[model samples]
Target: MRRLEGTVALISGAAGGIGAATARRFAAEGAAVVLKDVADPRPQAEELTATGAQAAGVVADDADERGWAA
Candidate 1:
């Protein structure tokens, strides 16, 4: 569906498992996706992008409030 065509979703813990699945599902539903993980989520993002999805990956430590201070 094109319900999310103009949406942007930021998903944490997206390197694998549920978060990864959610990102893929959202992309399929037409949302631009931002995948965040402590580990590198770039590969998953790139894979989504290759399928003509708008996606980006971010390495972040959600535990550290300081890290998010940008």
Candidate 2:
């Protein structure tokens, strides 16, 4: 069984660099990923979705409390 099967992961700073890399790894492990970044996380999320992984992207600044209120 995949280690992350039936799991959901929310990764911050996922627009690029290590955060994006982690998002990809989690999806490969069979987790549905929710990627959040101040930048655009959609491209990474879309890439994962195209590969048949469950993924989504959110544009939000983690430091901003108001971002999550939406």
Candidate 3:
């Protein structure tokens, strides 16, 4: 469907569960995913990236905007 073709998606709370599901969906639709979470997402992100999906994980507390800016 090319729902997210050429889009850059910043997904907050994306370390697992709903957030992770959304990231996967976005990637499947061709969006570049920027995952944000307080926990580490290296393994998940790497797995997704290996599947030809553009994905990267950023560890941060969602309460802080400064973290998002980084």
Candidate 4:
């Protein structure tokens, strides 16, 4: 069994750099990922999904909870 199997992860800063790397690694470990970025998060989410992982993106300002409401 995979270490991250049946787990769900909420990750921020996933549009590039270290966040992007972590997202890939997590998915490879069999975890479902929710990618977040102030900018476009669709690409990263789509990439993970193509690799057979569950992924979704929500555009929001991480500093503001209102953006994440609901």
Which structure among the candidates has the greatest TM-score? 2
lDDT for each residue of candidate 4 in 1-70, tens digit (9 for 90 to 100) = 7799999998899888888888889999999998889888879999999889999877778799888676
Each model's TM-score?
0.95, 0.96, 0.87, 0.91
What would the per-residue lDDT of candidate 2 be over residues 1-70, giving only the tens digit for each residue? 7799999999999999999999999999999999999999999999999999999999999889999789
Q: Provide the lowest-lDDT 10-residue window in model 2.
A: 61-70
**In model 1, how large is the Cα lDDT of residue 29?**
94
The most accurate candidate by lDDT is 1
Candidate order (TM-score): 2, 1, 4, 3
Q: Which lDDT value does model 1 have at 34?
A: 98
Candidate with the larger lDDT of 1 and 2: 1
Model 1 TM-score is: 0.95
Ten contiguous residues minimizing lDDT sum, candidate 1:
61-70
- Of candidate 3, the 10-residue stretch with the lowest lDDT total is 61-70
Ranking by lDDT: 1, 2, 4, 3
Per-residue error (Å), model 1, residue 1? 4.3
Q: lDDT by residue for model 1 over 1-70, one digit each (tens)?
A: 5889999999999999999999999999999999999999999999999999999999999999987997
